[model samples]
Target chain A: MKRNPIGVLLALIAALALLASACGSDDGADSADEVDSGDTAESTSAESSASAGPLRVGIVAPSASNDLAFTQSIVDAVNAVAGDRELDIAVTDGTFIVEDAAAAIRGYAADGVDLVIAHGSQYGGPLQEIAPDFPDTAFAWGTAVDTFGLPNVAAYTVRADQGGYVNGTLAAQLSESGVLGVVGPIEVGDAKLYVDGFVAGAKAQDPNVTVNVNYIESFSDVALASEAATAHIQNGADVLTGTAQMVVGATGVAGPAGALWFGTQSNQTPLGPDFVVASQVYHWEVVLSEMMAEIDAGTFGGEVYTLTLENGGLVIEFNDGAGADSSVIDGAQATIDGIIDGSITTSDG
Target chain B: MWSDFFTTSVIVATLASAVRFATPFLLAALGEAVGQRSGVLNLGVEGVMLCGAFTAYYVRLNPSGWGWAGGMATAILAALAVGLCMGLLYAWMTLVMHAEQGISGIGIFLFGLGATDLLFQKQVGVPLPISGLRPIRIPLLGDIPHVGDILFNHNVLVYLAYVLVPVITLMVNRTTFGLNIRAVGETPEAADTLGVNVNLIRLGAILIGNALAALAGAALVMNTNIFQQNLTAGQGFIAVALVYFGAWRPGGVMAGALLFGLVSSTVLQLKTLGIVSGAASALTAMAPALLTIVVLVIVSRRIGQPSALTRPFDRNA
Candidate 1:
């Protein structure tokens, strides 16, 4: 049969279109190559100096590396530790879906990265399964403490409640309305811990103060967070705080309303420089450095690292832009000292 | 706990939030209703929304010293243009190439999601705040006690949504274009025989629908005053579902959106007031989606979907 030239041309064009669409879908991973290239540059420098290359670190996070929340906290820690060093770092971000995260984690392990960080609580179960497969690869997962009793798996979690307590104490002192609002993400993992501590700290400061907490049941729904913040303000909450990436929405509301806002996960001063009084900055490096040291010492896993105020893992970073009074700063410092010295317990009332 | 929830302040707050939250959904769903009514089902609304959101956010961030109002206008227009372009692509794939509507839409969605996130990482790097649209109170109506706070005080986009509902309803029910759309949706062959340009009408409907969906994205970012990855957060899908729940009518879609928005706001209010404990908050958070499903099931039998919905047209065939 004679094939029509026009028909063949159309077929070729259609095939190309199909291929283009398929390539477009894969473009998400291509964006990550920029991060990978940075790692390559560092590893190349390290390889020239030593028979063994730099300590390779791979991270799989649920949100963007710059989300200014849970994921960014660790990403910042990794970058800080990698600064002026030969440590290699690679990250696959926006892996909110568990299956996608699992694939990335497994890929990293297959590539023989020295340490793989599974950076979400949702990843605990998958790490439990994958860690055993890569027994030689050091695996660190958190906001959780389950190591699956595996020798190569290490778990790290933030004592976010400690910083939450400090924030709550300062909020209570600064709040003229004597009403504080907290917009939490899902009531699980570190988010719930932070809210519980904030409420406790507020009550500790003023028993008569009304502290309202709202869990939006989503870690990434900024719109819901904004609505929650607005609702809190309407109900006479002069001070607001929240955890996770979505808190940007809440902080946006609070900043414009001239309400005080406390933040967590990472420094939220960038979100609302004028309103953000202080943030419970998660210096994961405080724990990460220790974990890496332990890994270097042949303690590959079976240990859980906890970030605490006493250990300086969770730092209360005051936003200098917010114009917090000296007395307020002094009071916050006193509370931090109290928590560290075991004098003021952060237990939920 | 329940007493806290029943307070007038809580009710007023929830109602006000409901109106604000419903704006995006109503706009997007109404747009989708128009497209579905014209026989094309574009599941790429979510992707289109993401694109619109990023475009609006980028415009808002740079502003080029356009000032607040000018920047906001520029952002909305930019978002609309992106949405219209996306609509054209979807129309070409489904109308000309006869690609599977669902798969093509999924492709568009993935492209939107990836492309937006990539651009955000490269351009913005960090989520930044913008001077978003602020609320405007309607003169005497805004002073009418509870009703004023609930209905008459909202951002300009919310008011636009309120106005679009009636305008869209009229356009769909009482105009020549409306008649042609309905005819093409029901029977493209008959409409074609009657001298209606079936493909052109369908293409126009797709463009209009997607453009509005993109505007919905803009409304969302403007209302929130900030943008982040996946900022729409499945609101686009909910908007699509809302069309079915609304029985593909503007008024019905608005009702569906209001119901969802109110339920969601109330759930957060209840959680805030401690009427719903943390252990049960997850379940309460599901209330809006659950209610949507239950309502959809109840109304499934009464409302008929467009016959040509999701099916591509071929003149020769």
Candidate 2:
């Protein structure tokens, strides 16, 4: 018998394909069983107020939960909320592709979890499609305002501009070059809003200061982001800021250039300890707690929640290790106060 | 938009940016050109690049405190080693095992993507910054008006790419080894009859191509000074396509890369200058890829790919 290598290769490929499909289905079935057990536990624990079973929260995000950017901000907030309560968290992260995210979202809903968070603006279309199907299971999503007017859906967004304003204020005050660079992911949602506020705040500080904004038009193109930052630095931007996971690339450039960096979504101090001046940390718990309360009170959805500076959902965390002057911190606090008191508007003029 | 983009300062800046952007593409495409010229189409260049980028990032992150230049050299060497290893695996699967080149390449790609992401998550839990190689300006040349800033002022890798383009052109077209590569790629059986070891030459070509592809990845990460999951994006695939776009010639590939780099940098500059409105970003973002397709279609008529580009060679046949 002659050994046919091609035949063996074909068989190996087929076997691997089958194995992949099997593993995918296995994950689906495992989640279904977990949901089934969760439903049973929920019903049993409903009667016991003195000892509540863990409140299961499922999250589907666009990137890793520890990305130190957009997704991590919410994950950190959720963890903080869970610290004082009995909670079980299930996360399906790195779902940048909408189809994968949709499957994960539906899987979590089928699991009969108390709350399912779809944590990306891109997930809105899929959530709108999936939310009505799960009327009993509360669904929350955003960086968007449209709840699709669905009864079982809640929409939450951050006034990221508020924090962006504070960051820009400090960035302007600390800039010796009087030029700031903004490396934005895409010109939409929170990223765009943050850039607009940042530019506005920078101009408000000193009308003559130049603020260069570059939207690399990608959420995960780290290389492009770095190039954009390099271009910015070459063009004389002494201070920089960016939003999304790709900002890691921008910060990488800025840090080495000794340029002050303002970050959004999560604390980016770890990425650039000596260069990261501050971060606009998103504290989603301010809104998440409210959504959880509403769900517990028998309201399935149909409300929009916004994270604002006044509500303490967005906080400007200054990096003390970055050698930021107290004057800059004071100015940042003043800007925050102004925004909260409606004395300063983050809106572009 | 044209008015702003046409300024002297903007033109020089855009050119400089283009050179920086084109380095990785040029390196990878030139590598793929060599491999394709030798009758192999390793679509796994993208995967190989990802592995290289990760290796380089990891090396830079956990440096031997070998100073900046020393650390960069170490990272580049490690990336090349990884690329060579991947090339060997690809060669074995496609050449020895007689696996389908397309599927095997895809398999390599998937393996690289998943393995790199997993290892990165496990070892480096979060993205960290490294002091990447900075641009080194050639004193006299860098001082030469606009030309100096655009062409002479770049990182060492970019300069290497500048030299590699012409050197590879010479190696591929004007050398005896080049003739053997063309002969094996065109007619392996005839080459074998002439006493050339087809398999040995193919293996060598694959290894060299992969090493270059790995260097492309290293250059990308080092240029950026940071690494993230899927950091190469689809640049590797673009690099592969560029070989065809370049007509398998080093010069043509460099030209294609520069075109892409310039277009991309211009779009970014336009977007930054607020000359291109936000509403037009989606269209502008597609500009580089769309232009590549148009160029490829135009060039396809006159230039032909290597005859046996993806055909597996089996001595038994």
Candidate 3:
């Protein structure tokens, strides 16, 4: 077959066009009144000058909202907060490409959602752009580092590293190979920080611990994650931990091999019986509870909240099962309690 | 990494991987064989396979906690029904509406992906588990050296995959339906003039192809207890590629599937042994695909595709 130069050129042009579209952020702006119909349950009591209609909450997920771990937690949190009050919560899923996120935020703002919460760290830039457009609506985003808080948007998160550190300690003690493995979606700041914490925590538990870290480069590739775990296992890494949303593939590979596996987000003990040793779980209830309490107390505004062991934002659950038993759970619990009691402090302090 | 190859565990891992990889391809190919023999070229195999995988997982993982065997059966039947419906739909669209065959096949794929993803989100949330198929060791054969571990001690699907190859080969190369299918695919007008119910044969092919795709999906979920969103990961495409490798013959497809299985198993073995260093691991993972592309290039010259491949039959033509 003779290769067609024009066809190749057209294909290139099409690819370039797609890349350009995928690269740009959404710039469309929408007015608040156009979207929110006043019928949602409004607690007339929330401090942010309760509007005639119920609260309008918007959530933007850089990844799929169906992600049962991270994004799902935030969705559950919004649902919990909306459960009591007059609230209409709208969510846009699968916003990995930067521009789609901007469009989602603008659309939510136009809909007159009172509070806009962007779950992924990558949404920080777009959230900042749209927060100014909808000043009346409060904004809370989950960011790894210091939040560049805008007047309307506030960054809120916990010390994920702190919890990772505790879990790392557990993994180190359980690892027979002294080679521990960590699988994450991408090497972003948020994930990097977690890995750093895990390495530190592992070393703290046992000075000689060696940790191997690999990133799947995408959140959606479970097969890649499974292969990575198998490679790590083959390398004599007895314990495996992942920061991905669903640890099914990773756990599947690790469990059958009789290696220790740890999960992130929710307690995944149900995934593989006696496989997961510990999980760095985020208690969305704590964040939602605090937000609800503040809103009810008539004190809603842009405020960045950090939920750590001190405030119970994040906690580590060391698997108490006999087969996946770890003494490090006790040690980590003690450190957590000590931190809460002001006796122990991480570098963040 | 090479050390892993010599170890006892590596042998088990490779054996497991081969069985795992072969299950879906075997099922899909078996279905394709039925369709091809009936004189139809059903390109909607990928879509049907995905639908089967999703449906089977949902049935198995639903609150009842149906065992893996039940899940496989459900998946197989569901896929078969879907295949039957899709086959009828394709026949109606192509035979009645006279739409382009390639276009209709693409439409089927899009419909399957969207419908499955949406239904999965609404129904049985992600990460559904079926009582997975456990390995059963055959008495004397399972006790043999390295080969026994490779061939025996497989889940029911593995054995089925192995047994179905020859059964399908015999059924097609040796049966009346097989001749009818080949004739239909080659010269539809001639078959029609010969008093064959052209529509019936084509519809049967479509239904059978779809069911086989579904069984492929079932094998996938049964092997991996947990089902994630879009778990097939282009294995449907891989199965189609296998058809080309087998030169569209049952025996050829089976051999190609086993070859791909071995390639996959070898990669996993290398990873386990830490023999694949640094950037090589990524290459190792792609080994199966690369091997497939290479084999296809070499084999395409020897094997001729169906005369009416991808072409919807026209009464005038």
Candidate 4:
């Protein structure tokens, strides 16, 4: 049967639009909700008070809460910071779509949460728009410095390089091939900062060591990340370090090849015990707790919080399962102390 | 750094990576070629791939009581079944319901991506590792140094993808079914008048195409033993593009897949060897797609697409 081409095309477009809307954001929330610490509608008294009651905190992240990459870093930190202070935490993760994330941010702010952490750089713009409407609620977003200069918004940025440098220094020691590899997502924001710092520290540790870096240009292309790591291994790279969630792919290849893996953003020890020597864990709690304290002291958001080694915001967590020698641990600690003090200098780029 | 990239070892490693990379593309693009040959455009190849990859990974994560072989077989079958179901849906939309092929295919892709992500979240809350298939060394052939590693040291599915190219070529070129498909795709009115079932041929082609695409997704997830949302990435769409780049021939499709694989691998290798950096590496990464687009431009004028592609054929009309 010959159908009218134009009519069929119009009908398909209409059906697709409806289907697309139905399938898109609702699934994003359902997936993220599974990873949430608290049910979406559970504990809410329109007054978010950190001093008098448990601090009500809500998080909107771009990927899964346990992605073991960017999103996990903040989620882990928030959970950690809940110590001593009873914190009511809710998370809407896997909101990689900016618009969906924006909606989630607005919802949290409207709920009168004490702090709404938009845990993605892309959410910066959305936070900017949503913060002014909820002037009483403090909004924090990052790996970015921009707070839109809003009185009700705070910014948190990480010196991921502080940890990346330490990771690279350790990588240089663990590598027998003297050739290290990096599987990067995209060379922008924290990913780039981490890679640059890794290279600087590795080159500083062993000037002749070769660190081959491959930016697969995608954060979730696990297959490509695997191939990149394979290429590195095939070419004699015995130590691999990478950023972003896709490093799970790299870690998978590294374990079987007997190559040591160094991680960042979150403690990737759970990725595998065999390959993960150490990780540069982002302890956002240090910065976050400070922000919460400031808010409790009647200061709304006029400051930028930076996570640094000195501030105890970022720490090199040695995977005891990998079982590194004392010398390796001592060297990493020394590098950390140096970066913390004035001795060790890192490339900020 | 430049000298390191030019070494024979690096070259061999790059080629090996390229071959591994090409496996998924070949599986998907070859299936797409078959579907296009039958005058149907299944743009949802990517979506089907996502569903397939997730199904395979989820199944692989939960090992059945029947050991490694059984678990592996079950996962593969499950993924293939999902593909078949998706294909049936695509066929029903285009063939029975007479929906516009392009738009409906996209809808399928979006649905697959979203649905798999939802299933993954509900079934497996976090990304966990599984024991994926390991590379098998062919008896004597695997003993050869670099050449053996490149060709013989591959998983079963990798070998299957390469083997299917010729089998499909033979089926499409030599069989009566192939002839009927070509006739229906090219001259559906005459084929229908002569008692050929156009819809049946198209349906078969779509089902076969979708199954292969699903296998491609399965191969990707099995390689890593890890499943995330959109694990197949944009490989499905790339496979569709490769069909056109190959002028809809299975041989040409294989070449296109291999070419893309090599270029991508080579670019990655260059960066890995420290011979390329920064924006230059980014630009070089686009080589495969650029090369494909150039071929497409040349083929558009010289070659022919299936005459009745995307058009719903009605016997009454």
Of the candidates shown, which would achieve the greatest TM-score relative to the real structure? Answer: 1
Candidate 4: segments with Cα more than 4 A from true spot: A1-56, A82-90, A103-114, A125-134, B64-70, B143-145
User: Which is better, 1 or 3, measured by lDDT?
Assistant: 1
Arranged by DockQ, best first = 4, 1, 2, 3
The window of 10 residues in a row where model 2 chain B has the poorest summed lDDT is B64-73
Please give the lDDT score for candidate 3.
0.66
Candidate 4 TM-score restricted to chain A: 0.86
Residue range with the least summed lDDT across 10 consecutive positions in model 4 chain B:
B61-70
Candidate number with the higher TM-score (1 or 2): 1
Distance from true location, Cα of A34 in model 1, Å: 4.2
Give the residue spans of candidate 2 off by over 4 A. Answer: A1-4, A10-52, B1-3, B65-70
lDDT of 1 by residue, A264-335 (tens): 989988888888899999989888888888878888899899998988889988888898787887888889
Candidate 1 yields a Cα-based lDDT of 0.86
- Please give the ranking of all candidate structures by TM-score, highest first, separated by commas: 1, 2, 4, 3
Q: Candidate 4: what lDDT?
A: 0.84
Residue A25 of model 1: what lDDT? 27
Q: Quantify all predictions' global Cα lDDT against the true fold.
A: 0.86, 0.85, 0.66, 0.84
Candidate 4 lDDT, B1-317, residue by residue in tens: 67877888888888878888999899999999999988898888999999899988888887864466448888999899999999998888889878888988888888887788767766785677777889999999988988998889989999999999899999999999999888888989999989999899999999999999999999998787788877887899999989988888888988889989999999888877767878887888778889888888988889889998878888987
lDDT per residue for candidate 4 within A1-349, as digits (tens), equals 8868657755765676456435433443453344333522232333345568877788888777778889888877776776535567777876877998998889987888889899888888778888999999988989888878799888889888888898888889878889999999888888898999999999999999998888987788788888889988898899999999888888878887788889999888877776698898888989888999998897879888998899888888887778666688787888988998969987844
How close is every model to the real structure, measured as TM-score? 0.94, 0.93, 0.76, 0.91
TM-score for candidate 2: 0.93
